[model samples]
Target: MGKEIDSTITFQNLSQKNMSFEQVFQHIITFMKKDPSGNFRLMFGTDSQVFNHYTKFITGIVIQQERKGVWACIRKVTVPRQMLNLHERISYETTLTEEVVSMFTKDHKEQLINIVIPHIYKGANFTIEGHIDIGSGKKNKTRVFVKEMVSRLESIGLKPKIKPESFVASSYANRFTK
Candidate 1:
């Protein structure tokens, strides 16, 4: 048989545990179905922290309804050794975010978009974004990488967001990295 995705790979939030990606998508669908006319934003972002011997990375997936709240979950991955290099860690974080975004194939995106298509004229919208932990602020060490990393996210069809605007990475995922 062809290689299959590991069942052990799961995303979790406060109320759920060990949920597969498909399960998470179903939850997103159910949430959207409840208010199809609302504008929505699906965002994914990753942040990492280096412990003594290993590095921890957490990626957050958030679905937000404008003027409404959000339903979010996170997936964690660990590297065997600490990653001290700034560029490498940032790149890896972006890669992790890309991997999660890739899971939503064209058809999956279409399904989400369809839910709001009919209400588009009424101001309903569905947008997907990739949040990078780096920023372009002069005082930021990650400033040098802003161009390259943002370009990388753009290549994958995401509206790239960074630093302060990237709360999913800087705030949500960062919280669990510690």
Candidate 2:
């Protein structure tokens, strides 16, 4: 948000927009791939608690677990084509831990968070960065790639256990661009 005379130049919220769910999921997956160091554990939860909580939360909504365990949980979540948020995003990467990680992941349980995280970042424009790929390419084509991947998943009847709800304007994560 920026001040422009009496009014402020604001970033638009596209949460209620029309879009594909695949693109959103892809972003999250890409980010997870970058989690080679395990720092991402903070984003989801302590160890595997996020997965368990995810199953419990969406149990009756998108899934009905025949059996449950600690290793993994089968649950359903909304995978929208796109989304938008109108709040200020907070810096929460290394600072995150088990407690808040559990809450954020659960709180925004419905969105395809981290799906396209490789591209939609907080400081993408102001930095030189390292050898980045995928997200930095033709961004408009982002949706095309995502949908194709989703089509493949659907073909295998593989539900990722995570889904995001779409909107009319921007394609966002579970809630804020966390």
Candidate 3:
């Protein structure tokens, strides 16, 4: 829902900067091509931090090859004022992840899938996960919205993960929300 979802937006990781979304897509495809036999999880997640004046939201896109390596990049959006409500922040985070997910058209996903289909019987697998920065544990304050958030992601065809298992949101993207 923010400008970061636009075609002109840029995504960056440690070794790169100002990379267009197309470049990011190509990067993932190239990584998979390098090891088509590896299990890949293409995940999207967002985390936010409420600064004094604004909330900094960061959405991460990661292509992880189990027991191997990963290629990840993040897009950022900053709201003009601090977002104090817990539900609002969590919902906004999901919205941000959805925005990034919408960028990968059907053809783009097919391209990635085609690369691994040949190696499927060889242990190669692919899954798309939506990681929400909320937990279902009783002690977790975000537990209340877990169902809603998970359902939102599931409606988009993604397997949803949360809390301890949602490393992309709870760990990766969170680091930059500061």
Q: Alpha-carbon error at 24 in model 3, in Å?
A: 0.2
- For each candidate, C-alpha RMSD in Å? 1.8, 19.3, 2.7
Worst 10 residues of 2 by lDDT: 125-134
Candidate 2 lDDT over residue span 63-177, tens digit each: 1111221111112232232212111011111012112222223223333333324444532211100100012135433333344433433443233111121110022122232
For residues 47-75, what per-residue lDDT tens digits would candidate 3 score against the true structure?
A: 99998999999999999999999999999
Rank candidates by lDDT, best first.
Answer: 3, 1, 2
Winner by TM-score between candidate 3 and candidate 2? 3
Off by over 4 Å in 1: 1-6
Q: What is the TM-score of candidate 3?
A: 0.96
The Cα error of candidate 3 at residue 133, in Å, is 0.3
Instruction: Please list the residue runs of candidate 2 whose C-alpha ends up more than 4 Å from where it truly belongs after superposition.
Output: 1-18, 41-178
**Residue 62 error, candidate 3, Å:** 0.6
Q: Model 3 misses residue 66 by how many Å?
A: 0.5
